[model samples]
Target: MSFEKENIPSGVGGNMADVKKSGYLKKLKTMRKKFFVLRGESSTGPARLEYYDNEKKFRTGSLTKRTIYLRSCFNINRKSDGKNKCALALYTRDDCFAMVADDEETLSEWLQALLEQQQAGLDGAPVPAFGKCLSSQLSTYGKLWWKPKGLGSSKNLSGNYRLCLTSTTINLVKMNCENEDWEFSVSQITSNVGMCCMCNTCI
Candidate 1:
C-alpha cells in the first residue's frame, strides 16, 4: 500500500516491506499510472508477462514494451492485511514490482492467474534438443562459463561449457569435445554454497 520509488532495484532477499507494510501511504506522494497487463502464449519458449504504459498503446498492438521474464521470478505475494487489500507484488531476481486490483475479489483472480503463470516457469522453458535424452524431461539448459578453483589464470583449463539439467544428474559438456575428458560429473565437485544449491539440486 505504501508507495516506493518506481523502478528501483531490490535485493535478492526481496523487498519485505512490499509484502508486510503499508504504514507510510499517507505521507508519500506517488505518480498516477495507467497500465495494461499482457500475457504471452503458452509454449516451451521463454514465458513472459508484459505491462503496457497505457490503453491506447496496447490497442494499437505494440507488443514490445516493459517485459518481465517469468523464468527469473523468485517470488509472488498478495497483501494479507491492509487498509487496501488490492495490492499484489511480484518479486524477480533484481526488482519488486506491484499492481493494484479493482477489489479484493479481483485481486484473488489476478493472483490465481499469476500463480499459474509463475508455476509454469518453474516447470522449465526453452528446452534444448539433446539427441540422446528424449526419455528424460528437461528442467533448464544454458551455456555456463566454468572456471575451476586452484587454477590461476589458466585459459586452457577454463572455458565455456553447456550445462544441461534433467530429473537426476547435471550434465556439463564442453561445446567442442570428442571424448569424455571434458564431461564433468557430481564426483568431481568438492564443495558448493548451501543456499546456492536451491531447494532441489537436481532438475
Candidate 2:
C-alpha cells in the first residue's frame, strides 16, 4: 500500500517508517466511511446515535480502540418492517459496540471491510492459524453404539455406530437408527497415559 505523507496530520509528524512502526498506517489504509450509521443504541432508544467514522484520523483527539483494530462482527436480525435497517455487533477484546446500517448491502460492505482489516492486522503476527485451533474428528461405521447424555443403563447398547470428534465434544451417531446422536463434552472425557500425538482421542 502507498503511504501519503500529506495524509498524516500535523501532530503525527514523521516519515512513513515511523508511522508504520506506530501501526497508524495500517489503520489509515483500511478506513471506511459509512452513512446513516448509529452508534450505541438501546431498547427504548439510541443512546448516542450518529453517522461517524471510528477509523478516521483526527488532528486533535485520542484514537478509540475501534479505530485502531476492529476485530470481528456479527449481523443482527430485525423485523420484516425494519428491512431498511441493519444492526451489527462489533467487538474487541474487552469492549463491544453496536452499530446500525441503512441496508443489508451497506452492512455487508462494512462487515467485509472490518473483517479484512482484522485479517490484515494479524497477517504478520506470531499467532496460530485459525485451522490449527480447531479439533479434528474421525468417522467410522462399526458395531459400537451408545446412548445419548443422561442415559444411565449401558446394558445391551451395542449396534452400528458412527464416531466423530469436534472442537468441543464427541458425537456418536447410531447408523440406520432413529435415536438422537449422543454427544460427549471433551472435558468429560479423558485420554490414556502415553497416548500417541498423531492419534486424536475420542470422548
Candidate 3:
C-alpha cells in the first residue's frame, strides 16, 4: 500500500516475501525523520514541518501516480466565504487541515501559488509515464454508449465508452476490449460543419 522499494537481494532462495518487517529487513532499510521548512508570504516567520513515522511516512523523490493526479481529486476550500478570509482549508481523503494566514492578501497569494503549482505539475510529467496520466484536472468522467455517424439510425453504433473530459481535452476510453480509444483536443474541433458534435445513447 506504500511506495515500491527495492527488495533485499538474497543468495539463492529468498523467503522474504512472507516475512513482514523482519529484523534482517530493518538492518537494510532504517526508518528516518525528514524535516521541511515552509516559506509563505505571511510575516509569522518561517514554519517548520516534520514527518516522523514508520509505516506511512513521506519520502522525497519522483512524483508517483497519486501525486501526479492529486489536483484532479484534492480540493482546497476557503474557510469563510463571507467576512473572515484569512483561513484556508486543505482536504485529503479523510482529513481536513486548516491554516490561518497573516492577512487576507496573504491568503489570496497562497491560494494563487497552490493553483499555479497544480497546473505546473501537468506540464512536468516524466517521460515513459507509468501510463497515460492527464496533465490537467479531470472535470467529468462517465460511461455512455456512443453512436458513430452513418447512413442508418443511432442504433448501429453500439460502442460503449467512458468519456474523460478536462478543460482542454476530450477522451473516449473503450469498454470491454472491442473498440479503440479516441482523443481530441479543444483546438482540433471545428464548428464549420454544423451539428458535427452529436451524442446519442444506445437503448
The most accurate candidate by lDDT is 1
RMSD of 3: 14.8
Location of the lowest summed lDDT over 10 successive residues in candidate 2: 1-10
Question: Using TM-score as the measure, which candidate wins?
Answer: 1
The candidate with the higher TM-score, 2 or 3, is 2
| Higher-TM-score candidate of 1 and 2 | 1
lDDT of 2: 0.33
Candidate 1 lowest-lDDT run of ten: 20-29
Error of 1 at 50 (Å): 1.2
C-alpha lDDT values of all predictions = 0.43, 0.33, 0.36
Candidate number with the higher lDDT (2 or 3): 3
Model 3 regions lying over 4 Å from their true place: 1-135, 150-158, 190-197, 201-203
Per-residue accuracy of model 1 over 18-62 as CA lDDT, tens digit each: 221111111011323544343433431334455445555544555
Each prediction's RMSD to truth = 13.9, 17.3, 14.8
Q: Candidate 2, residues 110-176: lDDT per residue as tens digits?
A: 5555444434444564322112211132222122434322232342334444444456655554444
Total colliding residue pairs, candidate 1: 0
- Can you give the TM-score per candidate against the true fold? 0.42, 0.32, 0.30
